[model samples]
Target: MFGPASSRSRSAWRPRPAPAARPGGVSPRSARRASGSEVRTPGSPPAGPAPRPALPRAAPPRAERTMPQLDSGGGGAGGGDDLGAPDELLAFQDEGEEQDDKSRDSAAGPERDLAELKSSLVNESEGAAGGAGVPGAGAGARGEAEVGAEVSAGPRPAPLARPPPPVPGWPRPALPVPWGTHPSDPSCPGPRAPRPSHPLWISPQALGREHASQRLFPDKLPESLEDGLKAPECASGMYKDTVYSAFNLLMHYPPPSGAGQHPQPQPPLHNKASQPAHSVPQLSPLYEHFSSPHPTPAPADISQKQGVHRPLQTPDLSGFYSLTSGSMGQLPHTVSWPSPPLYPLSPSCGYRQHFPAPTAAPGAPYPRFTHPSLMLGSGVPGHPAAIPHPAIVPPSGKQELQPYDRSLKTQAESKAEKEAKKPTIKKPLNAFMLYMKEMRAKVIAECTLKESAAINQILGRRWHALSREEQAKYYELARKERQLHMQLYPGWSARDNYGKKKRRSREKHQESNTGGKRNAFGTYPEKAAAPAQFLPMTVL
Candidate 1:
């Protein structure tokens, strides 16, 4: 039984070994039974029953066998590769890379966006400020649109209205006058009636004879004249000359009362013999001077007596010769009469009488007065002797007198001298200058007193304590003050003098204090300067 048990144990162990082969391959008994004989082929190991096809790997649990999509696509390569990497881990790593890339992209994008935003904002700001269109609008396109719109709107305004052109060959139209009822009246004209060529109108009185006589002849009439008409010499032939002369004479010598009372009668022509002797043919003195013809004088005696010897009755003379009865005894009866000499009359006697003889020959022009009567005589009638009558003959016979013009010159010179010697009128003073002068006096007095006090303090009882140069400086300062005061109050000399005296006294005292310190040249030594370091940089 022991032997069989041992054999059985060996069989059991062999079987155990055989069972182990089952893992490697099918069991030998099963292989022999299946293959008919456990035959070995040449050069090859005996193949037992197909080694029980690897248990089909139990189809690896469905989830464990499937790898993530990454493993299939070249994800797992080496031993140390992340094959065990969880899907979440791989996804997390991928997500982390994506996040990093996104972060970089976000940062870069923000920068790019910020730059773009900044550029856009800058463009928008420029556009708003410049009144241009939005930034993206092309510049050339926008300008063209603006120009096209402006041109399409309207034509440009004209510069200004041109003045209406002047009418050809004609003046501006006359303003229309309103028509009245009277159509044919000259005063209510469409165009004003042409002004009369001679518009002057004369009054009836101005055309009368007495008015004419007064203007043409201002002096006394010739003694034997039949009628007083203007002398032929006085006629001004030219129209303008006549008008001017007539107007001037009318203005200067106005018509007298009753001058134009009667209309002048027409003149009749006279035979030569019928004409008055006093109207003997004469040439005007003016014509005689201009013409070559010599004037023939009338017989001297006949011409002299012609107008002068009017028949005077003795009774008319006796009326002016009345004398007092008591003065008759004093009158002498026999008056010596000088006899007339027989010599020929001198040529000078021609102008000696009250009237001059007519110098022109018969039928010549009438004579003009050498001096006009109005110019000769004073207008006053009475007191003729006091103011020299024009007819009075001077003893010397020469008409002009030396002292005549001298009187006006003497009077004017005297008046001018009197005016020159007159005292000057004082200008009126206002309160301001007076007040200013008073204030200036007070200031100057106070200043002088203060200066004296200062000098006195500096000198103490010893009045000559200061050096000459210091005295000069003090006096100069005082002088300047006085001068300033005088300038401020222009005419205040008294105050200025007082200040000057005070300054002078201070100067004298200073000179005395600096007792003649002599240098080698025998003059006072110059004063030494005080130490510069000790002095203040700025003066008070």
Candidate 2:
């Protein structure tokens, strides 16, 4: 009678047996019998029986006993109690019906919901994958959203396409090159090659710009002449041309018409309005003193003013006449003849007829008297106004001859007087004779004094009693003095004829005094003569 359905029902409701004993050897059944349960019955099934025993009084199955343990372990004590109660059994049956209803609802809608969830998960994964490629995905999404909003308001334009990736080995887009510059790439436009820095033409533009920026603000500009010409903002092409034109005009053109000329008129005087208030007129002390209202000048002022006019200086008339006169103590005179008788009216004489009067007109005397022609003229005689003849006349009461005529007469008289006086006087003594006379006298006096002194010294020396050495020294000193005097004044050794005569006379007298005796030195007795001394002895 164990149909599949009934068996399933019984299995579900069965109580569990006690745990089997472990391998160590205790039996749970025996333990249970010992704890006051029945141990055995006469028709009980064996322990190893294939079929289970029949229930007593229709009790629940043994498996049903394990349900509380399972429920308690899985759920709690309340779950164990619920598993044992009939009401819980009914609630569980209702719970099963509710679960069936939920399963049915899930089955009915699961295909569309699962598909929607799978699509959302796929979109998230793809967006995350795209995040690796895009640099700012969130920002891009925000931008897209904004663009969508714009589109909703009106038709949207397409986003601009990104530029193509830079090609390898190709040059990147170069910055704009300045004028006269070549790009890093040789083929680029402008200059064909990079220019080396030129020493002479080196540009100061960069350095100048830096200096200009530091020194000049918006209002003030550089004051340098070059800077003004080169300023980029100035009128184009005008600066260089204007400067060159100015230079050329300065170099080539004539100076301005009024240049270096005196000014035509004085500058207009400044009016009171034109003058600054702080300026005051400055008057020099001299000007102020002169302009003051003083009636009389001071003595110092008069003296200062006197310096303006100096006395006129006159030439020396005596010195002028002396210089003009040809001979000493003479002056020239001229006389006009009626026309020299036989040599009548030569052309030169006719020329003299028209000559201006020698004295000039009464109001205008001749400027100078010493004319060359007037000094050469010959003149008439006897008239008081005429030039006197050299042979003249009366001693008394005669007017003095003209200076030139008088000079001639004086020269003739001087010659006559000189010839007449010449025979009366004897010839004059010459310098050589005078010199001989003077020298002879001097030599005689000196020789006499020196000879006397030597004699006295020799006699006084006690010659008979003296040693040879003492006598020799005295003699040597005398000899040296004589030699020195002769060397120093060679002119004193009188050698002329007069000197010789005087010496001879002295020698004769000396011979007489010595009675014609010759001394041991084979010389006559020495005459008294002075010791010779050098002239101009002060220097020594």
Candidate 3:
């Protein structure tokens, strides 16, 4: 059982009597205050708790400090001594701070001097050109020195405050303005026009980066092998048959070297090294003249068949016949062979000269030229055999058609040649095409249109509306593509890709000639289109 407040509980809760007062009737608190007044030798720290290291707090006004009066003479030795005591104690108390202040002042001495010099110069110029008009004035020098001394004695400008240390979780405040600007300056030319850049031309194949732009497309102009293979257009294949035909014609039967230069007639194609050994079943006699190494003379009975011939003379067999081949005995004393037919010379070569041919033996066939180089002519320069042969001959003074070969190569051969040729190089995209490639998808998304026709129409209008500089960018890109294409295919020509025309069949040709039905009026009739009539409807 616990006791009541008046009993043992009261004794337990009651405060103990205060400790007996110390000697001299002074309490602990009063003793502590008096301890500060006790003097200690300089350099030794104060007793008891060490003073907190002083922070750079602003000092009080100088007027508050009790200084020695100038008017009052030294009253007594004790008073004089005490007058300096307070000041000495204050200086000793802030010794560390004073040293710090001295160090900062020393560090900023040059900058402060420069600022003071500039200010003084500006002030002097504005107020009155101080001693400037005088030829030699020591007054200006004295003034400058005095101003400098005053400025140095005064407080130096506080160094610019640094940014506060970054807190762990908070974002940093905007960094201080660039060094050349003033504090809190907002107009620091923070926004600058972007520098213009020019793109370097690099082929798509050369690029190592794999991105959306480099993807292959069948309908798009090719930029790489993959793109080329993807493309469905084959320009080279379409033109291959025609181009090869023309090329073969030129190669097999080239024009004479010097047709009109000399009075001597040119040799026949039968003499050329390029002439074929055997005749093609489809080639006419005209074509056979170019292909056959040794062609048979035309029959003498046919008046339409004409040829060039020389007087009966011993044929030069020096290059063709070797003594070991036993061709010397077989050489005809006079060989009458049908040479290449003659035609009028060009306007530059004066007038036409007809060298009538003598009737030749129809069964005789000329020997093939033995050496390829000798095909040009005999060893002699001015010899008749030295003259180059004309590949073809026009009908003499008549526009009548002559029998000629339809095609040098068969359908199967042409098809095979086309299949064997390399894939054609794709044409480079133009400015508009390039622009469309880049912006088509963007437009499709914005317009929500999937149809290419509609998208292309919109893109085309936008392309025309683009600024000159914007369009120029695409043009430059296209130019770079073309340049790269040229570098890749130096020998390629646009003419090679010219498409071939389809040959008309005999039945189609007849149909084209008699295409429309004719009446007794002797005129073919054309159907007239009916005019449309818009029906009017009333709106409800």
Candidate 4:
């Protein structure tokens, strides 16, 4: 593989070689020195391949500022050549590198000042791997002979090159407890694992994508996101995309059918008026109010006692007598009722009040009124009837033929009335109430009979027999829970304040004391909750 000695006597298949050193043993670099008069031996190899062009001098390797003349890293591929570089060449490299250092230091001075920021949040003393040096600068790699720590004659080894820390000025994770510092892992510890870095928030686009996936694939997801999020919470968050319709990206539609159009795909016509008459209510709106996903998890008294369905029809109240004292004297046989039940008083009375009564004796069970419109008193501005609340009749529905009865109510009206009857203030639970509430479901689930009334009796007797200390503990828990409730529902005060005026007027006619005995604690029962406002509806 050397000069003319190699590949000179080639095989017939090989190309003829160009002659070298034709008149003298010379090459291009030395050709200038070779005169035409010079001669060469026939067997001598042509001058060795002309010296390869001197490589452009390499940029000096980065150096650390510490007291080392060598880097931990060795010369990468050509360690031997680096060791044998000429003395002058090595000296030149040293000069160049020193100049580069001066230039970089001077230039980076202003940049470093600008880079330094005041972030009190990040502790400076812990993990101090950044912010004091130029980027990409490091201890220059030198031969082992010049590595100060190992070499007897060399200068001291430089400080270890530090990695850049988390980019300055961006918030970093909360500082972790150092190894041997955490209280729980006290024994057999070396270095502690770094604390997990929880991002305060992800980018909106990424969050939105996750939310969309969860919304579209609620029960059967493509993949579980390992965000350490509480299970299934993001799946139905109130703030997540609430308006994902038929066109959102994650929502898929069926591919267009190629099976051809149906000849009679149109639906059959039905009487629209009767469609809702017997619809079974699509699992009842009551199911929506249940905390249990399945409606049957709790007793009927707990979940089904309120909001029970009522027929839409108004009841026959022709036999109902008014609640007024009989000594007021004989009243008229004909009275009136508000058609929409009642309306806020204004000029436009879309509904009229009328109820024709049957002939009545002086002491008839049904009472009459000359001014039933004013019977309840001045507070009620619209036509007043025997009813507490009346359903808004449809514009086209048949009118009720009977007199108004306070107990007669439609489903919607009954719901409104029940809400009205609820107490405005949340009654603080006693030990018994809390115990019963907690254990009621347990009893229902465990008992063979599963009768709510039977469960209630057992609970009542058990509660009476509970030790005072045990009861006190539960009572304290209930108090804390109630406090937490107030914290979570700060606006409950506003809900409790609703319908205060109506309550006052309704209570005005009642007696102060009941004939029944007070509770064992000598406390009176609480009054009803805030009344649900029965907003008047339009016929349309």
Candidate 5:
């Protein structure tokens, strides 16, 4: 038999022809080359492509016909020939893709229309409800209407073609809509197909750095139609009645009786930067809102045609609030009750000293700091001016003198004095002390123990049984307090606190000698009364 190596020797080399150039710029030779296909010389019949090595089995396709996709191009039961000409195959593939796109877009149409309908409904409700504006604030109301019109007038973006639909018979997942939205309602448009969620790709580090940046300003107030109407020019024309400057109205208005005061000519209503209608300038909501300027009449000229005494038929809301619906012609008016004088009126109240006349000084007066006594003093140099004495002996007089023995004790003092002056150190409370203090009243209330001595004995037993960790917690607290104590009272010793007790005891010992029973017989000059004879018999 031939040797195994000889039988397996490599086959002889074969040459491939260059592809022919065609009008379509594609050739059969190039197509086979691109597809990685091999062929024998032309004189020999070309062999059929060897059966493709079977691929690992895949799951079967869904039974129902739906959208087409790139992956299914070759795997389907029917397909364009694998060895077909490149240009023809490419043309077929393009047509298939276009058909899939059309089918997907048709399915997605209803969903887009639904979303737009919902947004429109929300904008309409907002416009209809209006804002916090009062009944007849037309400027504020008009602003809202314009905003709603713009929203309704906005152009919609074109719908894009989708790639493909999901496998048929799969359960679709639901998404949450914003509050008050009705997705499935027949009145609202339904989407042709579900829209896919697209996620944004932001760097986490960048997001964190932005979050760490310092806050530069407060959040701006939400803009509303009412916000733009705050400008005096916008609001000044709202009311039909005349509005007068309060100060001028009070000063220049004629009294109830006929008087001959000439009315002051009013200044023209000009939009001068020097003086604005409102004391504080109002911020405009948007630049465009004020594009058209209209004449804003001054408040004083608004209602000159209507006189003050005329009665109104409707409710009067001149006050900031509305009047209660009660009786007609019940206009609120000021009542005058004779009030007693705030201070008693006496004969001395008849006169007040008039202000001094101005001198011929050239400039405005500057305050003089000279004392009244200095102003009245004469040149006669007598005894030094009497020292000013205090009006009362105040408790703060002690502050004038240094507190006795208040300075920290010095080492130079004798041992006896130093020991006597040492400050008393209050014993720091341990965990047991705190526990007992808190529980003493509780124990009494619960009737667990009546006597404090019994409670103390039980508390001691419990404290001894406490775990090391529990005991350490309280010890740490006490240690902190001890450190604080040393800082506050650096030089104090025990003797200072106990010394007061010893001093009181010494004083009481000396006083004891003066307070005993008096002697029965008179020791000094005073004569004792003669002893009275006693009757022995007792009265029955």
Candidate 6:
């Protein structure tokens, strides 16, 4: 009871005809043609001359064919056809000739076409060298030299010289110019020195965007300038010495040449701030002590007697001698002074000006400061007017101590107080802890495990199983977190969080409770849905 479909399936299976009998001993499948005089079946009459076998067409000449790429030793076993052969340079040279032919029809000028061809050839040479950096540059230069020599030596007539067409937007790639080479004749066909290639063409809009971004975020400074900017103290100290030396010269005036007698007691000032800056004030009694010949113990001796190891810093008294006509021997025995200047100012009868005086009308002097944070008082931090003496010697000397207030604080003390007020920073998670935090819930969902200990064990195995590249992500995240933590709390340390009580886990707290009031059902009302759990500091 075969249906129509079954009958059609049976008809579809037809016997394949026996492979056409091999005609005249020739393979039926091969492209070879039989003789023109085809033989008929043995006993039958021969048919009219069989259509003449068509002859195979000849291949085009190699010169007219496109050249194949040369193998640059980078080819593998599969690239047997790419192996470079003799006259390979001719292939590249021919390619340039082809470009020359196209350039004849193009709107571009001959010089530009020639330059482009030269650059293309040079880039090819560099590519063949596997990006050999400096050596590749040399190869490109040599390729350009060969191209120039070929153009000059060949019998082909030169292309008529014409000015290059103007490029309105993005310009064509420029030829490589060696370091220190003159740009006056870039197009001249001469052997150029080695240099890196110009970057590939970029859209004018992209270049403009890049330039705008550069203006917004300026490029990083050179290593030398960067180091100087980072350590401002060193630069400030240098300028401080210069200004300090100038002030020392202006403030110090040696007494008349004799022992024990002091300069006429300076006129007392009503208010120094009220005096016009143009009119020099009399030397303050503070610096007057510096001019005195009293033999006070050197700071070194005083610090030693007190068992302190502080480095001794004496006032630079060399500038004082420049204002006086005296020798070092006439000064106090215990005084330590700096070496005399190479060009000392002539002993001035009146006053010497180290720099031009300000022309601004009488007003307060411009406030001088290093760190703005240090401008907490009216007196400058390092100004000589604020100190009792140029040198900080112990109170053992006859000079009376100045009045002091215990309330005023120093910059260091203020900074400490601010830091004490800041809230403490929590420790950042490590790579493993971060990984567990992210994957712990996922693992719990998949494994149906409520116990965190079991879930963590699974995550630990998964963490180890992860490829190095995958784990590196967590490591990088952890590193960035630590960096942010350091910036937020520079003085924070792990020890600060140590020995502190940790909050009890929800499960632990539930177990600790005796029991919660049960609903009508004889069970503790599913302990008031415990509040959201806190993240654990450690993996377990």
Best by lDDT: 6
Off by over 4 Å in 2: 1-461, 491-540
As a whole number from 0 to 100, the lDDT of residue 526 in candidate 1 is: 18
Q: Per-residue alpha-carbon lDDT of model 6 for 58-142, expressed as tens digits? A: 1111222222222221231433211111112112113343343234323222222221332222122111221212111121222
Task: Give model 4 RMSD, 1 decimal.
Answer: 42.3
Every model: Cα RMSD to truth: 71.2, 77.4, 50.7, 42.3, 46.9, 38.1
Candidate 1, residues 1-540: lDDT per residue as tens digits?
111233322332121211111232333322322232212111112332221111111112112211112232133243221211222112111333334323433432322222122112111100111212212111222122111111111211110001011101011111111111112321111111221111111111111111122111111223222011211111111111111111111111111111222122111111111111110111111122222122322111112322211111111011111122332222111110001121012221111120123332234344333321122222221211121211112222222323233234354457756443221111112112212211221221222222222212211211111112212222222222222222222232232123222233333323343443212222211122212221111110
- The reply for model 3, stretches above 4 Å from the true place, is 1-421, 500-540
Candidate 2 vs candidate 3, TM-score winner: 3
lDDT of 5: 0.20
Candidate-wise lDDT, in order: 0.19, 0.19, 0.23, 0.22, 0.20, 0.24
Could you tell which candidate, 1 or 3, scores higher by TM-score?
3
Our tally of clashes for model 2 stands at: 22
Clashing pairs in 1: 281-361, 281-362, 281-363, 282-360, 282-361, 283-360, 283-361
Preferred candidate (lDDT higher): 3 or 5: 3
C-alpha TM-score for every candidate:
0.11, 0.10, 0.18, 0.18, 0.16, 0.17
Question: Model 2 reaches what TM-score against the true structure?
Answer: 0.10
Better of 1 and 4 by lDDT: 4
